[model samples]
Each structure stands twice: as C-alpha cells, then as structure tokens.
Target: MIDSHEELGAELAEKVAAAGDLEALKASGAFDELMEQIDAGRLQIDGKDGFLNLMIKAVLERGLQTELSEHLGYEKGDPAARLLPNSRNGSYPKTVASTVGDVGLAIPRDRAGTFTPQLVPRGSRRTGGLDDMIISLYAGGMTIRDIEHHLESTIGTELSRETISKITDDVLEEVMAWQSRPLDPIYPILYLDAIVVKIRDGHQVKNKAAHIAVGVDLDGVKRVLGIWIQASEGAKFWAGVCAELANRGVKDVLIACCDGLTGFPEAIQATWANTTVQTCVVHLVRASMRFVAYGDRKKVAACLRNIYTAPTIEAALTAREEFAAGEWGQKYPAALKTWENAWERFIPFLAFPPALRKVIYTTNAIESLNYQLRKIIKNRGHFPNDQAAVKLLWLAICNIEDKRARERQKTRTTDKESSGNHLVEGAATAGWIQALGVLSITYPERLEPYLS
Candidate 1:
C-alpha cells in the first residue's frame, strides 16, 4: 500500500511537470507560496470578497494613481508638487461592479478638477469586462432577466433589464453592417434553410421563418450570406432573397441545396440559370420514414439507402423501382412518392464524383448551423420584431465563429494538435481538396475563372 501511494504521487507530479507553463510557475516558487497561503486560509481565491477582488481593487487604485501622476507631471508625494498649481486632492470612495464582485475604489482626484481616469471612467459603475460578460451571457441564450438574476446570485450585483438590454443592443449596429456586407462573387455550394421562431405580430404571437443562406466559397470556408425573416415563403419571396444576394455581390452559385419546397428550384433558376438545385437527400429520407411504422423504419431505411447510394442516376432509378416493389414500399405508397416527386432534384448530385457527391448530398453543414440557431432561440419564447430575432441570431453566430477562431489560435500557439473544434463557418470544408478538384474538372469554364 505504501509503495502504491508513492508511485501514484510520483506519477501525478510527472504529469503536472509535463502539462505546460504552469510547471515553470511551480518551479518559480510563486505558485507554491500561493498554495501555502490558500492552505493557511490567508487567501481566498474565490467568492465576491476574495483574493481576486482584492487584486482587482489594488490594480484599479494603482492605475488611477498612475493616471493622476501622469496628468499632473509628478508622483503623489514628490517635492515637485510645490512647483505646480495643480496638486493632489485626495480620492473619493466609489463602488463599482466587476466580474469578481463589487470593488470599492478610492478614485483619485486633482486640485484642478481636470483629471479623468480612463481605466475606470467617472460615472461608470461597472468595468468594461462586466459589460462584455453580460453580452456573452446574452449570446449564450440567457434572457436579460435571467442575466440579471445570475449576476445578483453570483456577485451580489443588481442590474436592471433596461441596462442589460442596452448593453446587448450595442451589437445591433454590427448586425446591420454584417447583413449588408458584400459577399464573394462565386460560391461553389450554397445551403439554404430556415428555422422557425415565434414573434409577436400586433396582438397575437405568430411563427416566422428566419431564412439562412450558408455559402461555401472556392477556398472551402463556409460563410453566412445573410438572414431574412418572413411569415411565409414562396417562389416570389425566394426570388427576392436571391436578388438580395446578387445585389450584395454574389455573382454566381454553382449549386444550391435545399429541402423539397414548391417553386424553390424555380426561384433559384430564375436568378442563376446555370445553378443546379439539389434537394437534401437527408430530408428526403426523413420524409419517407415519416409514414413508415416504427418497427420497420430501420429495414425501410436500409432498403431506400440502395437508391441514394447507387453509382449512377440510372442505377438509382433502377434501385427506386426495386424499392417501389418492396414490401415496405407497397405498404407505404406515400413514402415512395416523396422520393419520386423529388427525383429530378435528388438525381443531380448522383452524377458527381464520389467525393463531390458526398459533399453535395450531405446537408450536415447547414443542418448543424440550424441546430445551433434553434438551440439559441428556443428559450426566447417569442421576439418582439424581426430585427430583434435577427439581432440575437447574429450575436449567436459571432459567438460560434469567435470560439472557433480562438481555438485555432490556441492550437497554433501551443504547437499542439488541433482541438478538433472545426466549425463549418470560417473553417475549411471536410475533404475539400478532392471535392474542389472534381468540381474544377466538372465545370472548368465556370469554376476555373474564380479558382485563381
């Protein structure tokens, strides 16, 4: 038992040593002293009135004093103070809320009354980081009221809903700018989808579709083209959406993937005549399974997989005939008809090479994005207006993209393997090289011009 305990302790020490810079800190003795203080109960590293809050208080006071010294051109107790008319006027007590807690600060003043501390500005009751925290919580799907209660429970800081809303509202201008920004001239693939969100229309709450367009550029980075809110969708509405994209600098889209919606293909063709409209095969499979009995779903899915997985369109057609003749197909005629109706749109992807075919047929890129968006808006029972919904959605997208960027940065700096935190947006599409090569060969005339 003694030997086992010794071996365990040594193994844990070895792992800690190999962890990272923390090993160097442990070697420096500073971390050891901190741990000693913590063990002795002389330091409390957590809670509202802890070591961190004390450090924050010290830093802010030190910063304010430094600013005052710089402004008056001398140290607080320096003999040079006699030469200047402006002298130290002591400090006034002010309590400000921070991420740690409420920190009481002795805000230094000048005899001249001209000094202003930029670190913690006058009349500001919360640190900049506190506002950032509020915005982050809001982006994470917390309502203003929820955030208010959270801060109060965590840090004993009470904030009004109006104040929280104002802080979140700062992102609205950014949302507008992003919505109106220019897009790439050419997108190799575009995925169109909508998520239903409830919004108040006058006296009653109505469900609205917030349409999203995710475009994969030639470089394989997924980009959100724009978002649109509509009560209902049709050929005319989609045409306007396409036209809006065109107006925002999208010159061409090679292929647009969407679920089977009436006149949707027509709308895409009207805008970009050469663009191939591909129906989402996953949606087709799901629709087929809707009418199937639960016990037979797996079997039915297995049988229908033969059609989509077929090598060629003709083979797919033959497979479809086989499925139509099968027992499940006979039992559920509507299941087969769903495929038959979408056959024209579904078969376009069958002609592509295997790699490109996989990329085109899989709607996982947009489906993942919609899944995230839905989770974000799920708690917000309803929005007041379209802009409110868009504002929240845009912030959520920014949060997702920001996290991916930071993870990539950390991986690069640490010289460690990727965290595997790849997101569809701002990251290369999976198997993009093989897919791009096939696309280049398939549509050299249209694709090659934009490749360079």
Candidate 2:
C-alpha cells in the first residue's frame, strides 16, 4: 500500500512489515504516532484487529473521514464542526474486500449526503480482497464456478461467473507484461524442458507442450525465465522459443544444460553462438537404464557411473571403453550405445571440476519445476486454450518461485553439501559456489564480466 511494488521496493515491504503485532508495534514507539493520528480524527483500532486488519480497516475509515473533513472545511472536534453549515452525519455500514477476508467499513458521511467517497464508492462490489481472492483461486487452477462457490462458502459473498472471470482476466495483462519484460543480459546457466498437457482446441482435445525455461543467475539463485505453449515439442517451435528469449534481452547464456531434445542445442546456438550446450548427462543415464532389464538396471548404472565420474574427458573415454568391454556392458548393450551416441555433448561438463560438473550435467532445475507444474494441473480436466495453459503454468511458477525463495532464506551455513561432496559450512548453495569457482577458472574470459 505504501506504493506499487516498485523498483528495488521489494525490500520496502519487509522494512514496513517489521513493526510486528499491535503490542510489539505499539511498544516500538508508535504510540506517540498513533496518538497524533487519533488527534487528526483518524486511525482507530479495535481489539479484534489481530495483525494489519485493524490498521487496514482504520486506514479505509480514516480516509473516508478525512475526505468528509475536506468536504465540510472543518475538523471533527474543532469549533468549525458546529460552525460549518453541514455537520457530521455519522457513518454507514459497508463491506470492503481485503486479502485476509471481507472487512466491514464504517463510511463517514456528511449531513447533506453530497459527499461520495472514492475508496469504496456506491454500488461497488470489488475491493482488494475480491481481486486478490479471485487471482489466488484462479492461479490455483480453479474454474470460475469453483471460485464463485468457494467464496460463497467461505466468506458468504457471492460473485457471478462473469464477475469471477473478469477478475481473473486481470492477470492476462500482468502475464503479458511479465512475458515481455526485459531480462538480464546474461544467465550463467539455463535449463530448458517441456511439459505436455491436454488443451481444448475447438471441438477436439489435443496435447500441447508447454516449454519452460529456468535460468540460474550469476549467483546460484534460480529463476524461471518464461513459459511457451505450443502444439507439441518440436525443434521448430523450440527455435521460436529461443528466439523469444533472445528478443527479451538474454544476449548471453554461458551453458545451456537441457534434455536431449534434437533441435534444442541448435536452437540455443541460433541465439547464442558462444553458449556451450551440455545435454543433461543424468538424462542419458536414465534413458540408458530404460534399455536394461529391471534387475540388472542397478548393475548397468553402477558400471556406467565410472564414465561420468572420470577425472577428465580422456579418462571418461577410457572408462567408456572399459565399460563397453565389461560383462555388464555386454549384457546391456543398449545402455552403452545410448552413452556412446550422446558422448560428445555428455563429456562437455567432464572437462571442468566435479563442482561445476555436478551443476551442468543435469536439467534438475527445470525438471523439478516441470514436476511441480504437473502436480498443480493434475486435477484439471483440460486447459480451455493456450492462454489458459500459460496462465495456469505461470501461476504455478509464481508459487514455486516463492517456495524456492523461502528455501533460499532458510538455507543456512550449516547444511550438508552434495551427493558425493562434503561442506565447509551449512550453506545450501555452497556446492553451487564451488562449481562457479571452477567455471571461473575454466572460462575466465566468458565469466569475468558477470563476476562482481
């Protein structure tokens, strides 16, 4: 409420919110300020105002009173209150929508009833809460009727289907704006993958692929760059997706760790010639396992591990030769064949230290994101259109990003390091930093510009 979520003002909310609860807030020397506000004929709090609800309600009521004061050219307790031709007409009951729930507002009045308040004007059903509630439920993949019923059941307030749809449509503008927003010049690493879901296309139901891009910044923090909905996963559509990312200002991508999508590497190179393509080694390993018998899958995986775990590409090739010559490799010939075919792209990460190799060898960033996206839309029957698919996935992305941010905060200097690595401290991203250090040494020229 201080200002629209602004430039570097993300930190503003936390600073403003540091006031704690009413008791602790009052104890923070706000009592004097509260008294001053009361003297101005504004700022009232009831015992029921648990957190900011009282403050929010008081803010609305206080705004109406001030508007009335301005209209009458007098203060509430001043002699002008009586001297004024029109006097205070008390207040009226009205419910204003708020994020927590609905809040009943006492709208201040003038004797002549000439004053029309602006915050919650006459015949207005919408408020902050209604809009927020609609967006929240809609983002959770709720249907319009579902949201309408939920609001009615929870808050005893009913909104029409049209009203619900209209409220949710507000996000389309935001989504478009976000999709077109300028991105950082460089993303150290990007993980690209897709999720397929059914979408209603005219009369028939068709499967559509929603390609998702997750970027890891110069720092280890991950961000989902964009979501693209297409008829299906194909190299042509993926090229267009890469083009869109380039248009959005992603000029340089150091390494793109992705699934073994045929045209994916080519699509990335179309935008960034210098970008190294690291086809996810973990993907190759998993696909290799599928070719092996279930019982011997573990045995094949153990044998194949030597190639990926080798100290250098030469060492990896040597291990590959040994695995290909081994009994397990002979039993599961297809597993070694899969590794051999993708060996060129697979060995790119092996040249670097294990720290960096661990990060770039898998598409875990977007893979994990896709897994969460699938979970959110699992109960959904089918997306109505491409836009609906985009909207739902975007909402799911927002939530997943928030959870990651919280986890980043909760990540202390005392966490365990990695699968095969130990730690200097508990910091969750210690392994990422260690990997970045290796990247700096391996590609000093490419990484120097982004290094602070």
Best model number under TM-score = 1
**What tens digits encode model 1's per-residue C-alpha lDDT throughout 56-157?**
776677778889999999987899789899999988999999897898789999988999899888789999889889988988899988999999998878
- The lowest-lDDT stretch of 10 consecutive residues in candidate 1 is 415-424
lDDT of each: 0.82, 0.74
lDDT at residue 93 of model 1 (Cα atoms): 97
Q: In model 1, what are the clashing residue pairs, if there are any?
A: none
TM-score for model 2?
0.78
lDDT of 1 at 298: 94
In candidate 2, what are the lDDT values of residues 1-452, reduced to their tens digit?
A: 33322211222222224554567656676655556644664433222232244455656676777788888888788875776679888888987655545667788888898988887888775676668768767766677778888877765566789988777676787778767878778888888888899999999989988888877776676767788888888877878887888888888888998887777788889889998999997788888888888888777788788888899899999999999888987877888888888888888888777778778889876777777778778878898899988887876677566555546556444232331111111112348878788878877888887786
**True lDDT of residue 219, candidate 1:** 66
How displaced is residue 219 in candidate 1, in Å? 2.9
